[model samples]
Target: MILWGRPSSVNVQKVLWALSESAVPFDHHIVGGKYGGTDTATFKVMTPVPRVPVLQDGDLTLWESHAILRHLAGGVPPLADQWMEYTTSTLQPAFLQMFYELVRTAPADRTKDAEALKATFLAAVAPLEWQLRKTQWLGGDSFGMADIAAGAMMVRACDLCDPLSPQVARWYEQLQTRPAYRAVVMTSYEELRA
Candidate 1:
C-alpha cells in the first residue's frame, strides 16, 4: 500500500492514525501542500480531484480521508461513521477556518478571522463534549475510527482555542494514551505551524 500526503495534513493524519492503530504496513510518500508532488501527471491519473491522503492498495486507489479510514477498518461502525460525518461536515469548517487564521496567517492579520470563527468552533465542539460525557469514545467505550477522524482535530483545537470542556479534555487525555494516537496524530507538525 502507498499513502500519498504530507503528515501534517489533518486528513492525512487521520489515515495515518488509523493505519497505525490497525497495524497496517504501508509506504508513505509526502505530497500536497509544502511537499508539492500532488500536481504531477501520475498523481493526477490516480486522483482527478487532486486531494491529499490518496490511498493506493494494489489495484484499488481510494481518495477522501474518511473513506480510506473506513476501508482500513474493514467495516464501518454506524455510530462511528455518524460521528465522523459530524466531524467533517459540522466541526471541520469552523475548525479549519480558525486553524488557517491562527496557524497559517500572520498574527497581525489573524484576530478578526479567528474571532469570527471562535463561536462557531465552540458550538461545533459542544456536541462532542456532550457526547463524551456519555461514552469514553465517540463510538462507545472502545476507541474506533470515529476517534481517528475527530481526534485528529483535537490537537489543533487545543492549540488554537481556549480551554476545552472537561469532558472533551478528559476524552482527549484518554486518546493520548493510545500508542498509535501518540505516534501518528500527536507528532509535532512544525512545518504546519506558522
Candidate 2:
C-alpha cells in the first residue's frame, strides 16, 4: 500500500494513526502542502480532486481521510463512524478557521478572525466535553477510528486555544499518551506554526 500526503496534514495523520493502531504497514510518500506533488498527471489520474491522503492498495485507490480510516479498520464501528463524521462536519470547520487564523496568519492580522471563530469553536467542541464525561474514548471503551478523527483536531485545538473543558482536557491528555497519536499526529509542525 502507498499513502500519499504530508505527515503534518491532520487528514493524513488520521489515516497514519489508524494504520499504526491496526498494525498495517505501508509506504508513505509526501505529496501535499509544502511537499507539493499533487498536481502531477499520475496523481491527478489517481484522484480527481488531487487531495492529500490518497491511499493506493493494489487496484483500489481511496480518497477522503475518514473513508480511508474506515477501510483500514476493516468494518466501521457505528459509534466510531458517527464521531468521525461529526469531527469533520461539525468540529473541523471551526477548528480549521481558528487554527489557520491563529497559527497560519500573522499575529498582527489574527485577532479579528480569531475572535469571530472563538464562539463557533467553543460550541463545536462542547459535545466532546459532554461525551468524554462518560467514555474513555469517543467510540466507547477502546480507542478507534473516531478517536483518530476527533483526536487529530482536538490536539490542534488544545495547542492553539485556551483552557479546554475538564473532561475534554482529560480526554485530550489520554490521547496524547498514545504512541501512535504522538508519532503520527502530535509531531512538531514547525512550518505550520505562526
Candidate 3:
C-alpha cells in the first residue's frame, strides 16, 4: 500500500495515524500543500479531485481521508463511523473555518471574525466534549477511527482556540501520550502558517 499527501493536512494525519495503529506498512509520498505534485497526470488519474492523501493498495485506489480509514479498519465500526461522519460534516468544517482564518491566512489578509470562528467551533464540538465524558474513546470501548477522525481536529484546535471544553483538553493530553499521534498529528505545522 502507498499513501500520498502532505503530513500537515488533518485528513492526511488521520490516515497516517490509522496506519500506525494498525501496524500496516506502506510507502508515503508528500504530494500537496507546499510540496506541489498534485497536478501531475499520474496523480490526476489516481483521484477524481486533485487533493492530498490518496491511497493505492494493490489494484485498489482510494480517495477521501475517511474512506481510506474505513478500508484500513477492514470494516467500519457502527458508532465509530457515525462519529467519523460527524467529524466530516460538522466538526471538520468548523475546524477548517478557524484553522484557515488563524493559521493558513496571513494576518493582514485575515478578515473573518476570530471570535466568531472560535465560538462556532466550540459549539460544533459540544457533543464530542459530552461524548468523551461517557466513553474513554469515541468508538465505544476502544480508540478507533472515530477518535482518529475527531481527535485530529481536536489536536489542531488546541493551539488555536481558547478552549473547546475541559473534557476536550483532557482528551488532547491523553492523545499526546500516543506515539502515533505525536509523530503524525503533533508535528509542527509551521510550514502551514501564513
Candidate 4:
C-alpha cells in the first residue's frame, strides 16, 4: 500500500495518523502542494482530483482525506461509516475554513480582520466542544476516524484558528497522549520542526 502527499499538510496528516492508529504498514511517496511534484502525469492519473494524500493499495486507488480514511478503516474496530460522516459532515468544512483563513490571506488582512476570523473559528468550535464534552472520542470513547479528522485540525489549530477554545485545547491535549498519535506526529512533523 502507498500514500502520496506532503507530510506537512493537515489533510495528509489525517491519513498518516489513521495509518499509525491502525498499525498499518505502508510506504509513503512524498508529493503534492508545497512539496510539489503533482505535475507528473502518473501522479495525476492516480488521483482524479489530483490532490494530496491519495492512497494506492494493490489495485485500488482513493482520494479525499475522509474517503481515504473510510476506505482504510474498513472492518477496523470502532471506526465505521458514521465516523466518516462525522469527519466529512462535522469537521472538514470548519477545518477548511480555518485553513483558508490562515493560508489564503495576507498577514495585514489577517491582522485587520483578526476579530472576525476568530469569531468564525469560535462559532465553528461550539458544536465540536459540545460533542467532545459528551464523549472522550468523537465516536464516543473509542479513537476512530472521527477523532482522526478532528485531531488533524486540533494539531494545526494553533496556526489555523485563533483564540483556541479551552475545550478544544483540552481535547487536543488528550489526543496527544495517545501513543499512536504521538508516533505519527513525532515521525512526520517533529523532525521537520527541528
Top candidate on TM-score is 3
TM-score of candidate 1 on Cα atoms, chains taken together:
0.94
Question: Would you list the clashing residue pairs of candidate 3?
Answer: none
- Cα lDDT tens digits, model 2, 44-116, are 9989997899999999999999889888888777887888889989898888888888888888776665666
lDDT of each: 0.87, 0.85, 0.88, 0.71
The digit string of per-residue lDDT tens for model 3 on 1-194 reads 99999998999999999999888999999999789999999999999898989999999999999999999999888988999999989989998999999999999999999999999998888988788888888878677888898888766687887565777777778788889998889888899999
Report the lDDT tens digits of candidate 1 across residue range 1-194. Answer: 99999998999999988888877799999999988998899999999887899999999999999999989888877888899899889888889888888788777766665666888899999999888989989998888999888889888788777637999889889989999888888777678767
Model 3 misplaced regions, further than 4 Å? none
> 174, model 2: CA deviation in Å?
1.4
Return the candidate ranking by TM-score, descending: 3, 1, 2, 4
Native RMSD of candidate 3 (Å): 1.1
Q: lDDT tens string, model 4, 2-118? A: 999987777888899998887889999998765777779888788767679889989999988887887887843453456556557755676666556566555556543555655
User: Which residue runs of candidate 4 sit more than 4 Å off their true CA positions?
Assistant: 75-90, 108-112, 160-167, 183-194
Candidate 4: clashing residue pairs, number: 0
Prediction 4 global C-alpha lDDT = 0.71
Task: Give residue 164's error in model 3 in angstroms.
Answer: 4.1
Model 4 scores worst on lDDT over the 10 consecutive residues at 185-194
Scored by Cα lDDT, where does model 3 land?
Answer: 0.88
Off by over 4 Å in 1: none
